[model samples]
Target: MVPPLVLDIDGTMTRPDDSVDPRFFDVLPQWDAPVVIATGKSFPYPVSLCHFMHIEQNVIAENGGVVLSGEQVTTNGDGEAARRVAEEYVAAGHDIGWGQTDLTNRWRETEIAVARDQPLGPLEELAAEHGLEVVDTGFAYHVKSPRIEKGLGLKSLAPLLDRTPEEFAAVGDSENDVSTFGVAGESYAVANADAKAQRAADVVLEESYSEGTLSVLEDLRERA
Candidate 1:
């Protein structure tokens, strides 16, 4: 039987511009189970990926701030709070990118995206002041609710798929993905993953990005 899988997009499947390696798709047909993408990207971003990959599974987006399956969208974080924080950052003369400054942020709900290069210490302090949370996805900094987490989001969708977290295999490469690892029966990280992500994973693949993802899928298929 094919194992269910959850994938991260930024460092795990694509480069900064969201460009995926064609070889990844060439090997996609080999897996026979649902492939759900769990990412910190805006809602539209993951939706496009699902469409491109021809995946019918639900996608967890905005760092578990939202879950989209078909036409239904379930949101767990506070979009209003996210927006407020973004405005506050700008008023304080912080150079951050969001809906007001970056069109991509307009499609995002539940979290505001800030450039990764921006100082996070101030953001964390700012979030704490407002009873919010800050998370780094290697690609950007997300300001969201403290309760939102990828593992919880993935587990919430299990009933829809008729499977549990223990039945899924997850692969990711960032601090934001650590929660995802906690719930998957099989978890893996690319060689380029940070030490925290690598430690949280059950296995660390030899390759990076989509190559590591392909390796994980092949190994899981063999074991199955």
Candidate 2:
């Protein structure tokens, strides 16, 4: 069986300020099953949670874009198509940026981060000429890599975890979490999620991000 829940960080587990819900920490320890953090966030954020939560399992970072199973690291270059799309936007000069994530907390000075960055600028025109869509991740704008977003990321990790589509769940509250929601057994979005997220979620949280993390996980606890 796969881990019961795959939690998306950022807008799901924490607020836009990068704070994890204390309530989640308060209650997660009592659960007996494994917690796999599935996120578009870099490695450091999830790593900190894993250490503090005493969680030991595979982590899917980079929006399910990268898989870290213990010491192993596998990133799907599938974002290549998406990268090209993003570059088109950059080339067009509309102000889009991408490559990798650099979000972090000052307290966790040396957290592990995945996703690399490329130079930005003069690409927006490129995207416009090509008529491609650019995905905005709050911190940066992703032009296009592939259909290889979060859902594909999860699909990549499925075999390694030995889980089917119906056995695992994904939870989040933002645009980056959409692809994950597409493939999760059960999907949820936090109350703070934007319209796009609301459309994708199977359930929406009543609690804010702080409490939402716990509430979302509590749903997982029921399955656990």
Candidate 3:
């Protein structure tokens, strides 16, 4: 059988331009096993992706700070602390880069995302003061509790599906994905993946972006 899949969104399933590759809408809903959307993005983003893809809404969002499976939702991390850190970073005279009406974080429940263009030093410093950590997703900087990670999210999700983390395959492409790579039974990092992700993955695919994800799905189909 094809193993259950945990897929990262930004640099893994999206085109280089950052839009989701439309092909997934055709592929994922037909997969034999469950497909979970895992990403550093806020909850609604991945949940919506699954919704529109016509797949079951299984998601690991906010860099593992929040997880959703059917009607069950489990949240981890100290989002309030992360928000405090972001507030302090703003007080230190830096823009979180997203404006006052920042929708990027509007519905987020368990962490904060800051624009990548913003200064990382102050954010990291402030996060440390609040006992939070920052993870660079290649799309944004996530401020979350160090105790939470995508690996933990997978672990949380596994029992809900009557499987184990080691029964799942993962695909991703950034520093934020490294922890997930470490825990998955098998992990693939696309050619465009950051060095950390490539190193953590069991295989680094030659194809880049969503093309690589499609390749992974193809391989899994063949194996099944």
Candidate that scores best on lDDT? 3
Q: How do the residues 153-172 of candidate 1 rate in per-residue lDDT, one tens digit apiece?
A: 88888767888899899999
- Ranked by TM-score from best down, the candidates are 3, 1, 2
Worst 10 residues of 1 by lDDT: 22-31
RMSD values, in order shown: 1.8, 6.0, 0.9
Predicted model with the maximum TM-score: 3
Q: Which residue pairs collide in model 1, if any?
A: none
* TM-scores for all predictions: 0.93, 0.70, 0.97
Candidate 1 residues lying further than 4 Å off, grouped into runs, are: 15-18, 98-101
lDDT of 2 by residue, 72-105 (tens): 6676554444445544444654333222342331
List, residue by residue over 2-98, the lDDT tens digit for candidate 3.
9999999988999989999999999999988888899988888999899899999999998898899989999885478878887888888898888
* Residue 140 C-alpha lDDT in model 1: 86
Q: Candidate 3: give the clashing pairs.
A: none
How does candidate 2 fare on TM-score? 0.70
Model 3 misses residue 161 by how many Å?
0.6
Ranking of all predicted structures according to lDDT, beginning with the best and ending with the worst: 3, 1, 2
The clash tally of candidate 3 reads 0
